[model samples]
Target: MYIDASLFMGMHAAVPGTRQACASFFAEHLRDRVWMTYEEVGRCDDVVWALPRDTQDAYYPFMDVLHSTMPVKRVPYTEDAWKTAADLPGRGVLSLRERLLMATVIASDSRLVTVNPRLLNLADQGLPVAAPENSDGRHGAFPEPLAGLYRTSLALEIDHARI
Candidate 1:
């Protein structure tokens, strides 16, 4: 399971009761299965570059947790990934970060566990997308119905902790 920045933020923010809850969730549910890309981790670090030096200290611990807990795999931007992203029909709508993430997933041949569903609809362009069934609050697993594949914010928050 490859996680993006949004999910990484959730883990970093786990505090007080949330910290214990997140720890139990990760140990029981995701420890061995979850992994993140170097690109994703770097994006988190990039946040520091945008913040003032005085504020960077406050965010460093969260960033440190992300760096230490999530196994980072360094994946380079490849021709095939760019080609796949270029082929996406609504490419114009995606931000640079989203494009890179889509491209990385394409290059890795790994499923993206994101809340964004519109990206999946662009699979016709060659990026294979699938949301986990457990991601849906009621389903506990992805259903064949397809309509409920993407998650709502509350479910995403829970799933983020699990990841």
Candidate 2:
């Protein structure tokens, strides 16, 4: 599953529960490995770099350790993904970052996991997406309902392109 920036930001949240939830999400997905696009990763890095110098110094090591210890799988932002981002089927609704992220998701054939209402709306429209929420407030596993949704969405995109 693809990890979105929101969830990624949650990992560093000051709220203990939020941090733990993000940690639990990573632990649960360790075996399968969590995927993230290069752009998203850079965005996270930028968040860190934008912090006060002392904070950056303090968190840099922590961030390094986390990256080294986590089960993260980096997804390259390839030309195909760039092209897809340029013409993503969001009808001018999605922001550049969202389109880039979605394009990478499509290029990698991975389901996106996010809390963004806009992206979730796309998921509601049948794109493969899963929220990291369950009744107990822990990270939920990938939903079976989203299994082939990405392919279906792609088919629709293709059909629409033909028109």
Candidate 3:
């Protein structure tokens, strides 16, 4: 599954129970290989660096621990994914990064785990999207046929005609 930046941000924002929720979610799901777009990585960095010095100092070490323990594979934005992003439904509502992240998950044949309501709504449009575990230890419903991990890497297709 592709992890959204919001989940990572939640780990350090000090929201009530959010840190524990995100941590538990990561601890359970990140046991296997997971996917993350490079954009999400950058977004996480930017958001973390913008926090107060004390938060930054604490969050960086936590991020380091996650990096050491979890197997997160960062994928680059591909041309095919970009095209799909441009054509995503509700394009007017999502920001460019959100669209690209959604498209990357689609092109890779992977599911997205996000808390964003707008992105979660895309599940109805045939895009595989789910939410992280809630405070009550309940997981969000994953859209059918996409609950399982399909690929280890981004599945980009090449068009010979375009070459």
Candidate 4:
């Protein structure tokens, strides 16, 4: 499943109220497969920088855990993913970062797991796309990761004809 940055940074936004929903969301959806986009990494880092730097730098410890211990996968953005994101009909409606994350989700063949209403709109319009088997090109295993970007070379129909 694709994860939104909010699920990460919001859990420790240096604000208790912000974390309540994020914590609840995670506790309720424990078993879903999860991945984070490069955009999300930057967003999380943004949160880290915003925190008051104490003697121990509390956020780094959490970032270290995210970078290592979490079962979450790190998916990089590639040309194909960019193209997919750029071509989205709803591109006008989404924030630049959200578009990238959604593109990564589609390219990686995972359902977006977000509490973001904008992305949920795509789900409502039928996202969580998988490759088509009939050779419109998305018919096989993904290509090897190019540079930092992961396997999304296989052409995919991003679930909704409208999106």
Candidate 5:
């Protein structure tokens, strides 16, 4: 799974439940050995947004421990990856960071592991979505009741949201 920045942020959340949820999610899925961009892995390193305390001293050490502990395969932002990011399938709506992340996943031919709703929308288009909440994972299957799913509200919404 291409691990997202949000999942990493969740691991360090002040809320015990959120922290545990992230941890458990990783524990269950990371045996496949996850991949993440250096940007994603480092997104929280210098930021003060979610930390309980933000200081230069605190920040450096936090980054150190996180780097040493996590077994993520940090993918480089290569030239082709950048080109792919420039024009990913879903645009206008998806953020740059999300595009870059997905680009790397596409280049690597791996499933994206994200909780971002925008990406989840992509999952609904057949990319596949999974987390602890869904009892493993669910295929973005064609509903039997749809008769022809192209007429469903979700399909219409996904079409409308397309770049």
Candidate 6:
């Protein structure tokens, strides 16, 4: 299971109680299965780069923990993926990175777990997409914890092109 930057940020910035909850959740639930993408780790690296030297020093340990604990899979952006992305309807509006990410997911035939569902809705252009069950705002109940984990893992696999 690979995690997106949103989930990483959520883990990083969650409130005390939430952080503990997440820590407990992850420790008890995802130790062996969870994975992260090089892109997502790169996003975290971008955050580190944006910080001041002293701040970076202070946060290095945490970053190390994230690095050592979560395996990061490096997936290249292939030519076919790029070509497919170019044909997407919102290609002009989407950022290059976003397009590559979306293409990577589609080409891999993996599920995507994004807060933005609209991007996935543009399936007319041939992008294979999936989102959390309740994300459409139609489901009344929250998904089961394991189900959420599975969804997250699926997203990661997509992002990492492991599928």
The per-model lDDT (C-alpha) reads: 0.49, 0.63, 0.66, 0.53, 0.56, 0.48
Query: Which pairs in model 1 have colliding backbones?
Result: 133-141, 133-142, 134-141
TM-scores for all predictions: 0.53, 0.70, 0.76, 0.62, 0.62, 0.55
- Give a tens-digit lDDT track for model 6, residues 61-92: 55455445545455677777788777666756
What's the CA RMSD of model 1 in angstroms? 10.2
lDDT of 2 by residue, 26-134 (tens): 5466456788888778877766666677666655554554566557888777888888787667767888888888888877787898756577788867777776654
Going through the candidates in the order shown, the clash numbers are 3, 0, 0, 0, 0, 0
Which candidate gets the maximum TM-score versus the true structure? 3
* Cα-based lDDT at residue 15, candidate 3: 50
TM-score of 4: 0.62
Candidate 4, residues 1-163, lDDT tens digits: the string is 6677665544443344434454444434444456777778777665445545551253454445334433676778977788888866566788887787777777777676554556667766678732111224222221222211211211111112111
**Looking at candidate 5, what is the lDDT of residue 57?**
40
Each model's Cα RMSD: 10.2, 12.7, 12.3, 14.2, 13.8, 9.5
- Which residue pairs in candidate 5 collide? none
Error of model 4, residue 128, in angstroms = 2.9
Query: What is the full ranking by TM-score, best candidate first?
Result: 3, 2, 4, 5, 6, 1
Off by over 4 Å in 1: 10-30, 33-38, 52-55, 116-163
User: Can you give the lDDT of residue 91 in candidate 2?
Assistant: 62
Worst 10 residues of 1 by lDDT: 146-155
Best by lDDT: 3
